[model samples]
Target: MEPTRLVYEAWKRTEKIIQNTKDAKGNEIVREVEFYDPYDVKHMEKIDSRCFLCGETIQEGIATKHVFSDVFTDWNRSRYPIGTHVCPACSFTILTNPKNRTSLRNFSFVAEEKLHLPNRVEMRQFLVEPPEPPFLIVLAVSQKKHLAFKGTVSYNREIYTVMLEETEVIINRKEFTRLLAIVERFLFAFTKTEVQTGQYNQQRVLKFGIDRWEWFEEQVKPYRGTELLNVVMFVAQKVEREEDVLCFMGLGQKTKTPPQPHLSFMPSIEAETNDVDQADQICGDKLNDSQKQVQSEQIQLELF
Candidate 1:
């Protein structure tokens, strides 16, 4: 992570903090900073995303309520800085508690048939600090119309704001890598197939089974086609530290094993095997002589 010219506040429970440091010119400078402000929030965008705090499915036009990050404290206060979304029910809970991070609201990922939802990113007693043992929180983007399920941070949070428009954010390479890892883990299931045959059969029998995730090499990874990856990868690269997230989407630890080699069978397809072959034979039996002769020539040509 490359260092940037910026200031960060170590969240203090009571007293404000100050530190003296020398700048590029070796001139002593004093800076005042405060930790992430308490949950002053705004409305959510009506569509394109599910609230990270609440398991609310959002849609457009029908619901005029804009889904927004619960941040802005005062309605008149113009500094409605970017934040993660929370639905009305969850929003009321937070308004009553102001600082509550944990929710009874259930979360899920479309990544796997049976998914393990990660733990919520706990609000520290002070400010944002390095996790004791690194953990993750997963967020899902709802699929509607022709859209497919996607993993993301914030839908309303504009990417270019942190990039082109200067903000208090300073990003480093380590943070970028961490975000990419989140995307790869949440979206990994798209690469798998139920019908295990040829190359696909080999891919499903991953050594780690459900516990492990496929790695993303950037150039090679494709989820919901490459278009989705490009948006996510760009968001991972561009967003500020606030967007750096991981989901402990797993309910609890299970005895993870390297799944046995060979392939797991698809019962639906395997069960119909005899029926398909029998139908084909029946069709072939009914062919007239001229039709049979034509079929034979087509088969010969295919072989040739």
Candidate 2:
């Protein structure tokens, strides 16, 4: 893939890192530094080689392991095999000139047949401008191990935040769309309000204070299965509107509830008989206890 203008600009801004070191005599000296030097011309030789990244033939190129040690880290041994070369241009792009270089551990890239966890500006360009579906961008949460990473996916040209578990990278479009619809419906149906106070009067003011991403994480991400549906259904039920429920469920049109069939004329005889039998059993027990109590009281009077 061709790098975007943003990537090129970022490359232009890159510069070599300089470091100070002490000599044997304890005199400090400044030197230009690089993780892997691309300009050490003593090792440069013309050989027919192919670049691993862009798949282009290179007349003057260096092995990927020499210059991409920091960028690919352990991936070089697995993803890009040995004897693979990278042209100077591609090396610059990958290394980003060292000053602003990024590693493969900061962002998660999920694509068909490949999954890479790393952050680079160039990678973001690809995600934002993908040719097809099933692409996701998850920013790694290096500080919090228990919390999920924040992810974004593009749908219909709109970006939505999604909470991703530590191991998750891909999400289906159907689920993404369903969640988007729920969030939109809730925001549309509810308008937040706050009370405002003045010297002489107090009034309530409407505010759009809730952020969609934060609300989703706090109120929706923790639930799953029937609980998730119930949460949304509860909100819809509170509004007490059929249209809201339909909209929250991603239904576009309102459906009329079918009228209940009349059952008054066709009552079940077995149910009626069971109810009568139960009632008779309860009354008979009560009567027997009352008669025994009265007999006991008469015998006590005769003894007296």
Candidate 3:
């Protein structure tokens, strides 16, 4: 499916749910949609980092006045910090519309992010614990409903899921393209086949819930736990384009000297000498979604 089409379908689904009034008090519940836009960017202490949204240097003045990032999460959470740097434009588009955001970290924030609808995994009963120490607690806010519409604030913690096999092959630029194409093709075919059978639903499939993840692994049990399945989950929705399959590792510069990697799951990140809004402890404090652009320096995941 085209990326735009898949994104639209997801939005349409959310729209239907939103049409009904909240607190109607029935079995049918519309899961709240969450986003990560912060207060006015002007008051924010700007970090000397690149904009995670467009990969451009965040110039002084208006270009990056609204920039923000989340705090470094517990080292036990994961090897990398839990956030990235986002530009103002991206902050507006992503925060303003539910149709323009995705749970996965692919695609540019300048563009509308694909929506990641809630599902059974999102239900409290099926939440899965991360395998390693650094508990990857992805924080989100329900700021989208406030865009052009009145709504209340809600906090949500989502798991950062890894769901593919990264070849880690040393390939030239041309080979890299071919590799992505092949990986995408196989996944598309597999998903199509599953959908044709009674095994998958387009809307609910591809979620990274613990039970779902284990079930997905069961299908290819032989490959489970092997080096073949090292890829991260791109989104909670079905496959659409190459962006969902590939990872944008890093897009910002260090505001301070890089901190050495810690042996404990909880690693220490050097904060900018002038400003630091987060801590290296439980990773409680947060900025916004755009600040999560710190993948390369904090995480060494084998990506596409």
Count the clashes in each prediction: 24, 2, 27
Task: In angstroms, give how far residue 59 of model 3 lies from its true place.
Answer: 5.0
Q: How far off is residue 49 in model 1, in Å?
A: 32
- Cα error of candidate 3 at position 64, Å: 9.7
**Model 1 agreement with the true structure over 152-266: per-residue lDDT tens digits:** 2111111110121111222222222223333433333333222111133335446325333332222123232333233233333111221111111120012132221111211
Write the candidate numbers in order of decreasing lDDT. Answer: 2, 3, 1
Stretches of candidate 1 exceeding 4 Å from the true structure? 1-131, 134-221, 225-232, 235-304
Task: Give per-residue CA lDDT, model 3, range 33-62, as digits (tens).
Answer: 444333344534465555443444543212
Candidate 3 residue-wise lDDT at 115: 40
Off by over 4 Å in 3: 1-28, 34-39, 44-49, 52-54, 59-70, 73-86, 89-114, 120-219, 226-304
Q: Best by TM-score, which number? A: 2
* True-structure Cα RMSD, model 1: 23.9
TM-score-sorted candidate list, best first:
2, 3, 1
lDDT of candidates 1 onward, in order: 0.26, 0.34, 0.28
Model 2 CA deviation exceeding 4 Å by range: 1-46, 52-57, 70-72, 76-80, 88-93, 100-175, 183-304
Clashing pairs in 2: 107-118, 107-119
